[model samples]
Target: MSYSDTNDPAFESMGNAAHYTNIASTLFFAYAVVSFVKDDANDPLFDKSWKQDGFCVTHKEIPFWNSHDACLYFDMMAALLLGALYWKQRNALGMERVNEIFGPSILGILAHGIGHGAVAHRMREMGLPTLAEEDDLDKTTIDENINERIMEINMMDDILGVGEVSERGRNVFVMVCFWVGLMKAALPNLRMAPFAAMVLAAMAGQQFVDRQFAFTYVQTILLVAFSVNQLARKKEEKDFVYATHPMVVGVPVTFIGWIESTQCSAFVKDSFYGHLIYDGFIPVAMLVWYVVCYLQIKESRDNSFESIAKTADRKGKVKVS
Candidate 1:
């Protein structure tokens, strides 16, 4: 069907979601760059106190930016935004679309596990300190932090009916990545190398498919979800503010993921790059997706109001006659 003539409300909703999500993604990207620039201004390397530290802590110890904290915040924001969008546009998009989009989207995020594990393996093989080690922090602490953040971020995924699948898939994907790392470490020339490479390729393809589907799904879901919520609640301002989180978090992450996947595949062999892709990009894309959806929905809403006004004017004239 032609764009305007397309009868499927879900498709229309998807387009709307994409519009809002794009705007949100742009804003978040700008904010992230600004945050990084502000933090980098301290010049930690020149500081004597920084020199006294055992490990090179310039990047980690920057006073203005805590990478881990920023990542957590971004993920949480993305989750909330996803929830808000789904809550508002569930009907127009339909439950099925919601499930399909969310299922693959979550999987796409999980795919980063392979890249993460691969990078860590490469670093260890080359005798470089792994990121977790370089930070002078225990593995347990990082794991705990990740767990907590996962729960927080996955809360919205659960609400939208794809959280469980995605979470399980992520766990599996991570384990696979770990195994790949171990293989790279223990037996770099094993006969299974070709098979392993094939598996990784398949996983990457799956992730891409999931991500693209999820983006479309979220777009469809957000339009109907928000409109329905607004109708029920009658509190537009409060809901709109609440809805902002999805746009802010989802769009940027999605776009970031696309960029990282395309631009940094070479680096994905390193764990740090993997983490950056998984932790950084996914949340950003989701935020972008939400912003795109929001704009379309808003325009649709405006047109609706105008139509209502015109209809009222016509009826008034008829009644007077």
Candidate 2:
């Protein structure tokens, strides 16, 4: 009758981790929002661009500065709310409570995975074109394609009934918002080198330990992978679909960075065996998971085939019935 016997801790830990992540996320986000509100001025980077095609000039301004800001604020708010809920229920909820949060957590993870994955795939499919080539693509066409994909993914979620957005998407949105807000507020003059370093550290932390601990690690890895893959393939990689694609190079690297960050942090720094708990461990774990899932799926298929084949063979042996 004990809760320990009835529920799995692995599932529960995910929820607890997510709850803590939300707490940190909220603090960062609040800082972002207050900073933005106080400094509502626009930067030159936000300027629009114009392209001329024959006699016509097309003008484009990036969408939703305000909306992006709002999303960042709201994402932080959501994280804070989740943190509060976790704090309230930590003692009474047990593993089931943690398990319950997995649905949302996974959804967030998948969202981020797909969004960036798709972008990488698309860039690859586009053949690693120059900025000019990318600009040449009709913005509306690109937007439509993105919208279509988003809709298709949304439908898949609807069928699954897990929640609205995928985990990856939520992660990407929230992380991006956090980064943008941070840049806008505290690090307005941030250089690429320092930004890259932060990204590397954050990525190292997230992949090895937990993503919530440091989200930027994921972004850094994604960008670097995309750059490297474009160089290696000599052709654009395919637009990312759901499965693990060539663009997945980012995942492992970021995971490594995250692990590093976790170990360095105050809470985990002195923990036992912390030295062995680097982000490098993530790849080994992922490889194991991949093999296990593949083997299980293959076994199921093989068994299904055997069952059908046996049934047919039995029927063949029988007289006309």
Candidate 3:
């Protein structure tokens, strides 16, 4: 059947998801760049001393425009946008389309929320204030001395610091990316959903896993498995795009991500450049591939029309004869 004649709602959903995802990816990428840039003073991203008042708007206690919280906020916003887009178009797109687009997303969002909540709980358990509950210290008159409150605020960074929260957000972002990609590829299954979640959990569960690069190794093994599975299911069909086409690319792309994450990749050793190349390369490449695929399909369709016209002309001449 022709592409336009395709009644497959799932295919249409994939198209919509890809359209929005490309935009989301680009926006996130721009933020990622700004987030990774080191200041002239050589302080790490989000590493600033708390104000003497102890709870200013820019304080780390709340989610500021810093690298860590920015990532979390951006991912949450994008995911909500994706869901809203699908929901608003649901009547036209149908149930299969809606489920395909929203299934992994809802799950991924819950996972991220839970991850953040767990960290917050840990912080409170350690006697660290979860967030700045009060307004600016100037607004609220407290009996406690200024120095005591400042000391407490300093401990906030010490106990409930940037590392775990940012790491968790990063893992959630990666998980969401994979989830959306799998949905777009029309490869979402019962197994794949949990597998993606498992990878996310494992990557974030660094405190549990003492071994270095364990997450990378796990991701590498998963990609290989997915590639092999897709290849094994290969079939001969002109109209059908092989799911394995993108699946195979994922194997090498994932390996590149792994390499870039480690110091072993010296040419771009885990710097801002490496992060950009690692995160940005595959999406851009896939986008170019999509455009080429569209052109090829258009050419094939035009050729098909020409062949039909020629056959009809020949038949008409025979009727005249």
**TM-score of decoy 1:** 0.32
Q: Tell how far residue 153 is off in model 3, in angstroms.
A: 21
What's the distance in Å from true for residue 197, model 1?
Answer: 18
lDDT string for model 3 (146-185, tens) is 2244344322233234467885565445445543443323
Clashes per candidate (backbone, < 3 Å) = 50, 36, 0
Candidate lDDT scores, in order, read 0.39, 0.33, 0.38
Task: Give the clashing residue pairs of candidate 3, or none.
Answer: none
Give the winner by lDDT: 1
**Candidate 2 C-alpha lDDT tens digits along 195-274:** 55654454334435221212333333333433332233211221111122112322443343334332333332234222
Report how far residue 246 has shifted in candidate 3, in Å: 4.6
What is the per-residue lDDT of model 1 for residues 87-165, given as tens digits with 9 covering 90 to 100?
A: 5655653233233243334333333333333222322333433354637766556444433332232212322323367
lDDT score, candidate 1, position 202: 38
Poorly placed runs, candidate 1 (over 4 Å): 1-77, 88-107, 110-279
Better of 2 and 3 by lDDT: 3
Q: Output candidate 1 Cα RMSD.
A: 16.6
Best by TM-score, which number?
Answer: 3
